[model samples]
Target: MRRRKRRFLFSTVCTLFILLAGLAGAALFFRIQGKIGASRKTPDALFLEYVECLSKADYTDMYRMLDEQSHLNISEEDFITRHKNIYEGIEASGITAQIGQVAEKDGEAVVSYNMSLGSIAGEINFSNQVKFRKEKKKGYQMVWDDSVIFPELGRSDKVRVSTDKAKRGSVFDRNGLLLAGKGTASSVGLVPGKMSEDSAGDLETLGNLLGISADAIGKKLSAKWVKEDSFVPLKTIKKVDELNLNSMEPREDNVKNKEFQDELLAVPGVLITDTEVRYYPLGESGAHLVGYVQNVTAEDLEKHSGEDYLSDSVIGRSGMEALFEKELKGTNGRTITITDSYGTVKKTLAAKPRVDGKDITLTIDSTLQDEIYQTFKEDKSCTVAMNPYTGEVLALVSTPSYDDNDFILGMSEEKWASLNDDERKPMFNRFRQRFAPGSSFKPITGAIGLSTGAIDPNEDFGGEGLSWRKDESWGNYYVTTLHDYSPVILENAFIYSDNIYFAKAALKIGYDDFMSGLDKLGFNQEIPFDISVTKSQYSNTERIETEVQLADSGYGQGQMLVNPIHLASLYTMFANQGNVMKPYLQYKEEPKSEVWLPGACSSEIADRIQTALGKVISSEHGTGHAAYRNDIEFAGKTGTAEIKASKDDRTGTELGWFAVFTTDPNLETPILLVSMTEDVKDRGGSGYVVRKDKAILNSYISGGR
Candidate 1:
């Protein structure tokens, strides 16, 4: 009876103790849950604290709070370089943050804050999400996400940027024909970070479709690892026509599957951007003048930064495009919008509009330009045609030209090599380089003698062969064609290109007076034009002894150098009644803000020169009789300057030249033309050909064809 009683009492006590312990454990669990819930609700406070720490440059604390992946990917050095400058100002401004609200969705928390940094104040709404995962040894620790969202600041005085879209300007010729303008070009760009590694094969396949190599695709795919921003472009494949993209073949087996195709479509990296490209209609003909446009390079970006100017996109490389770059380049603008972490549009914060560039119309006549090109194409040469009355360039041609379209897109190594290797030097603008003016300068010298009253039109110096007493080694010791010959008049001297007659005239006029004539004729002065011009140089020495030296100078030789344009302008004085117009390229109706006035010479002197030049072509012994015709009374002079020939030596090659001016009393306009050629042999008169084709082309203009 006693044992039974003891067993029953012990069992009842044990059961009561067990029930009490179970109730206590449940209460402790409820308390812990309440603390966690309270902490989650205070996300706004946590975000503000975190921002405050960042404002103070407490990067260690910031790093500790970041999610595992972000922590591993970003280093302290990288973070500092990226945000140090921006955050330094924020920290120095004694900024404070105020939490607005906290919300939770899809296992993440978001908080909004009003931030003030110095006098510059703005609102910043951000998300603070904690990721919890169990560890092997310890309890769970919180990992904070780095992504942040900002509220719209609206229009502010702190920043003023353009928000308007840039409408590219049009490029037109002097005749208002379009040469190059903005056009739509198809392109494919890659954002390597947003692309999946498994998509590498698909990218290669796509590259092949776009006519790019597999290696290029792989390089683009690996480019993102070096970038701070995930959206930067790795590569852009251009000239993607409609046929290519529509015919894309799916090499990836998964891509062929409909479900997988839909997934691939959701990939974020592959994109098409609407951008402007320069297009040339004339292509090769005016390539040097209109030039070409291309993408901005690293060098360009570095050269033009932080200025209120156009972004580094297209630039004029040469010709008119290069000369008037400032006028042609317009201002570019940008528009920005605020968005949430999910890329949902929160609001449009600011906008700016872009301005279109001005259109430039040149003084170039397309027909004349074509003529010049055709003429020079027959032989390697250059030509420049201008309107004497206005100094407006009608045509400028350099043969063996290149197509600007090649530069517009991009030149391959081979094409560049070919251009660089050409012997004709097609890239060089010969119209701007100096060459021997030859006999073409004779009329100007004759004019100087007449203007200065050093010689009379009727008066003559004997035109017998020239002879020098001091220097006769080169056979310059010849006597007169006729002993005690009749006086050589100015007309006789000019028509025959008599070396002795002009030498006597130059000596009588004196070197000072002769050089003064050259100055009045615009020598050694910048040829007022849009394009560059080479200034001609003439040697004027006080002493003369050698017969060959006198002979050379009288016939437009002996260190006389003039550009093609210079010679044309010089001849224009006769045609335009001694009024020299300032050369211009940009035209009216699309006029530049500035205008150049004409340069005038002495009319009296000009008429005398015209008379002499006329007699040279019309007279029976005229040197340029080959250029005369029946339609109009054309006057000209031919020159053959000996190269590599000394004052004593008579042997060497000759540079042939011809300058002419034609007029009709019935017509209002007069035409002036100058042509020159180098390295001709095996013909009469210095064994050279004067490129008669140039005269043939000029005839068309004079004939109004």
Candidate 2:
């Protein structure tokens, strides 16, 4: 037993010795492997890591990788700033890299790679090389240089940039007359840095010529810490002749005289630079249609970042200008050159020729627009005329208009405030403003009644006298009372605008069919146009508690509101033979037309309605008799809507409206006209609207002839 125990102890001791030996051998092997792994890292791998940092836009990581020599050349802050400038210039948030093979040259390592930078101009792809040197402690470090960002750059070469501004496009009328264009104008101002003499006297002379206060000019030019070269713009004058220097006597007040003008131009601080201004030759004729431009905001810069828009760039603010901004604002060109330290051009590296903006031609006739503008000078109203067949708007005029040139010429705050405070609301676009359409809406009701087979064209209601009242649970059903007209047929009802007869006709059509017919006519639906428009609304039948309420709506007296443009578009059905043409402002546009109520009416029904409309203008007893022309035949309807008075005790004002269309063979297409005058003082009903409508149409027809 003692011999066996001694043998087991010897075996266990040998096993323990072997286990200790194996662990020591493994530790030594791993140590040698780690050293070998460190020695295997080449400059190629270090360069790739740096490129990866660039791909990720990790500037801080890239800064850390720079050698002592590179750090000495550029502080970390300066490095960050330089990198940021490059990123913004190229608009580069991320980079795409194609790594090339790294090779040894003259005991140093060189890496070739391709980089693609994205900018507003386009993607700029280039090839570049990075050089590295071996360091005893650091293993390897890059030799930093400006060429790291752009391969062609050098120590002595500096980058110079120039912008070639593209000329803004011009706006032309149908006759090729210039409406808005770029023209040379005077920019009068003070250059603080250029002024070495006493500016008080010069400023006073300048203020006199510019019609600004001398004290105001002094305050602007003498502001604290103003740079010597800073230009303080006083005004942009388009018609220099209107400055009236010749009319001013030298001794009369402080206004400058013609003789002193030359002296004023010679002043040290005074400046009269010739600059481009957006000129409106037609003035306020079509101001609402052809908007104006304004300076860019910070938000505009952010939104158009890649487009290379400067902070001071001008942009369209409204109307057609805003609608076609992208097309009107042509691509601006850039020229980048390499310059010496002394600012001398060393080489012209790149040049991009600027492409000017394209011109725009409108469908409007400048002659007709100007004539109508002058005709409506005395009235506060709205007028819209369109070709019923083509749906091209010939003239869209709103009274109480403003001269858009005032805005471009830098209108004063006081002037802007006065405009806003005007009681007439001149800036208000009445073309799109909603109003109770009155008798103008009767044609739609008539169309609906005849098309739906709700009322017979020849059937007579036996002339229901003046007022209409039906026995009802709700109070008096007298929606409205009209003057007595014999034989209340569809023809007489429409010709005389007999509300009593039509109200009964709408009730006979039943609530569902009446509303359904309106639906077919596009009531309560969106009228798509280039400019914004308020949707015409109909009374919600779901809440229409009584028949009287519905009856009032049937005769165009209750909750019915429509835009002038929309009303004109709807009238196209009569002249277009049941096809409602889509209205457009731009010329030569083939807008799609839709069939109105295919299931409701045939062409015969539309023709019959056209005849009744003709009688409204040609017939002796017609309400639209004033619009009747001796030389041409036309169809029309008149309306007088009651508008609520501003004061509680005063009676409601009358709104006169007239819708007319002429099928004169002399014209290329049928012209439909819709005119409305609110708060009319004349109680001649539609007579006032017809007289004005006739004058405009007469002028248009006479001019065309």
Candidate 3:
């Protein structure tokens, strides 16, 4: 009886402990639930959560937060479409939200909020109110509407950005021949949402037909989470005629479709759109001069943030196109509009018309340019021709060259790599490279000697020797070599290109006067022109410690460097009566013809030099006699500059050079030609350079076609 009573008492105490514990657990659970419920009902907290969903483009979450009335009014698809449209139009880079105040109206709670979206243009700010309704199970459901986007937006209105693409200006040669201009091309595109998993094989087939990787196609088609209406471009065919439907084949599993044309079109949402593309009509001939354009990058959009430039805008990459990019790129226009959910324009709010870019004309003659380009197609050489009197560039040629059309039409990776890695450097502009002038510089030496009264027109020097140097006091520091002509006079020295005579003439001209004369002739000075040219180089007499260096420089042997453009321009002094006209490319500017200081000699001295140079083509003994023609009376000089393989090496490469000019009395167009060639295989020496000059001059004389 005692044991039973003890057991009953123990059971009673245990029951009481269990009951107390259950009551405490119930109280704790209710306390936790109340905190969570209050937190969910907080207007600021709920509004902030909704704002975060919009910023991340979580349309599903945003739609779930809407009240029963909003869900009944707007479908999930339409809601997502509306959000995407606004996001894409603004191209928002970032977003920010702030809850300002909460108030009660008509027994309903409303929260005021400020939202800001960052874009390329700047920040867009909007102030609006979000209504909330309390309900069972759902703490605070949003009474969502279009007014949440902007206070001005109504039930039927939507925000949109309308872009008005501007027309890029055309590029033309001096003769108004179109080089680069706007044209249309066919573009292949894909819509991701329409491409079902079963139809994904179509992309691989289309990729094969387009000569592109299937993976690349897939990446472009599904670049990011996109709407069903989003169109993504796979490739653009600039030359539609080159597309071959017969070459494209479908998969074995797709028996109904025989070719890629039918196979790709059978895929839902596949499309072909006509797109504007930059065209190069002149092809590779004027490629370097005209350059090409490419689509703008993210960095470019950021750099031009203040302007109306978008990521789709085109920018110049090189050559003259890059040099004048601002003038070539027109001002883009914009239109802000209100649209319906289906993207149908309800009203055009405001718009600004685009301004077309200005057209630019160069001074290059197409006919002459084509001839020069073709002639140097196989040769590693450079040639520059200009109107000596007016300084108008007639032709500028550098080879081996790539077709500019290749860049405009879209170059292959293999082709671009090949061009960049070529040993001959086809893309390099050889015309602007600096090299030794050799015997072609003899005229400058003669002019300086004559102007400084160092050489008399009748004064005779012994050109009969193959070598020359100063007296023993100079310790035979150096001996300059030349072609020996027995008892050569100054005129014969000029005709025969006697190096010994010129070496002696430099001694008489004095080192100081010689250096001054070179400086006057525009050596080492910046040349003013549309294209940049390197300054001519010569050794400073102050830096020269030996008499041999002076003698070598006198005959264009030591430390002398010049470019074809400036060399041709330098010869203009002879044709223009001692006036060195400034080289120009634009036709609008008035001609700048004035004598360059220190280099321009007296009229009498110019006449004397002209008389001597004329013998170079007229006289039988002249070195440049090969350049003479029956219809063309011309004067010029020839040179073979020595290129040492090593600095200390005695002998190596021979760079041939020719500088010539002719006066057309009928048109007053004095033509000057300067050419330089690398070490050619079969053709060697100045004679080869002269032969090329003859061919080029003959074309000009025969009406320049």
Candidate 4:
């Protein structure tokens, strides 16, 4: 009886403890639930949650948040897809939403908010209100519609970006002659209605000829927008007639292309049509300068990701075409609108006005450019012509060039291979490169010597024969000149192009002063021009180390290298009466003379050098006398740069140079032309280049240019 009483008391205490613990657990659970329920469930808060989903681009989550009315209008799958396509299509990002205020109307809660986002066209911002309704089953829920995605959008409206593509500006020469402009190209396409019944074989043939898959073509034909009579353009090709102009028969590859097209045309709806394309009017003559444009590639799109570039857009590939790509490419206009089911625009969300490309007018004279290009088109050469007084670059020519139009129209694989395999390297832009200026560099040395007082205009340096070495430190190397003259004064040195005289003069200028004077003349400095030309360099190293190196430099040989344009610009010092005029290619303002390198020479020294250079063309036995014209006074110099293994080596090739300018300032065409050619050995040396320049000058002077 005693044990039973003890057990019953223990059970009573344990039951009391369990009942108290259960009561406390119930209280804690209710408190947690109350805290969650206490959080704002107002219309503003619920709408903010919906906006939060939009900011994250969580379309599926957004679809679930929509009210029953919205679900009734659009299915869950279509709601998600529409939002995704519209957002991704415009490349939208950085979405933000801020709640402004809340109001109640007609028993419904309206929350006002301002939203903003970024897109490819620009920023898009709007103010809108979202409504929340009280439902019997779900106490409160946010109401949504197409207008919620974008203000003014309707249930039946379509959201899309309409692009108004800007026309690419044309490139014109000084006289308004077109260098690069718009033209027409051939497009290969098919008419769906005329397609063969058994198109499997026909499509295979067409696909192979067009260099695309048959499945791809089939998909294009089956597109909803493509009707039976619709013409489905497949590929763009070169204008057949233009590509085969010079030849009586089409090229082997062209014949193959034509035959392929003919076979396809016989089978089905295949046809050739015309489409607009970019044309290079100057063709091979202005190829290097005008360059060419091609369709943008994936890499191009990435490189210019934030710019107004479309996959089908073209970008400048070379020459001035590339240099001024930004200025030439216009801003494309865009309109994001809401359209109805009938394709009628209902409302515009955002719009950007289109700005057409700026038409670029250059200082290049097409006639002069073409004339100069024709003179050396068959040789490895480069030439630059400019108005010496004004520093306007009139023409820039590089020989053995490829047709830039061919690049735009389309070039065959075999043709591309031939261009690469040709020893001439037609695609190389020679005018933009630097080369040993040879004797053409003599006038710069003369100016340096005369301005630095290292050389007196009339001071005689006695006789040193045709070859002389300073103290025999040069070993077998000796400064040699073609003509032996007595009294090596500045006049005789320039007239005869005496290497020994200039070499001795360079030694007189010493290393420091020579470099300083050269710097003053724009050497080792960036040339300010539209095109990028390599800087003229005096030596490979910072200093002219040895006596032979210094001597050779004085004659424009040694390790000296100069850009053709830079060389042409340097001569402006004489024409401008002591200032190196800044060279320019754009025709923005009046033709004004701007000095590039001031104080390059004193006026007196310039006149003296100018007279001496004139004698170089007029005086009998003068090195440049062969180019003399009785009607016009020409000042010029000739140079033969020897490329030898050693000072005694004679088998090396030679580079010929001729730099000439008209002394007559009042002359209708005052041009300073510089021409250089490789492998001038035994072919009249620098005289060969001189003769070539003379003809171009005569043609230009006679108004042919």
Clash count per candidate: 10, 1, 2, 1
List, residue by residue over 112-211, the lDDT tens digit for candidate 4.
Answer: 9999988766789999988888665554577878778887787777887989898888899998899888887788888988988888988998888766
Q: Give the TM-scores of the predictions, in the order they appear.
A: 0.62, 0.85, 0.69, 0.85
Candidate with maximal lDDT: 4
Could you give the candidate ranking by TM-score, starting with the highest?
Answer: 2, 4, 3, 1
Model 1 C-alpha lDDT per residue in residues 1-705, reported as the tens digit of each score? 899999999999998889888888888888888776545534555555566776787767666555455656677665455345434422234647776565556555555556644411222233233344323222232343323312332212112122454455667766787767765443455656566666767676555444457677667556646452344332332333344334566334323333432333355466555455676655555666666766566677677764323454677778766676666766656534444555555554334456677877777766666665655564445566655555666667666577776676556677788988998666766667877766667777777777778877787564454443224464544322211234577766667666566666666677667667777776777776677778876653433344445445555776677888877777776666666555567777643222232334467767777777777667656677666565567666766666765545657766666776665434444445566665543444321323463355444546532
Candidate 3, overall lDDT? 0.75
- Runs in model 1 deviating more than 4 A are 1-168, 182-214, 217-284, 307-312, 336-338, 342-350, 466-487, 540-551, 589-601, 615-629, 645-652, 662-670, 683-705
Better of 1 and 4 by TM-score: 4
lDDT of each: 0.58, 0.74, 0.75, 0.85
Tens digit per residue, CA lDDT, model 2, 62-163: 887777789899888877777776565545545667778788766468888888755544456788888876666665678788888777777766666677
User: Lowest lDDT 10-mer window, candidate 2?
Assistant: 250-259
Better of 2 and 4 by lDDT: 4
Better of 1 and 3 by TM-score: 3
Give the TM-score comparing model 4 with the true structure, all chains together.
0.85
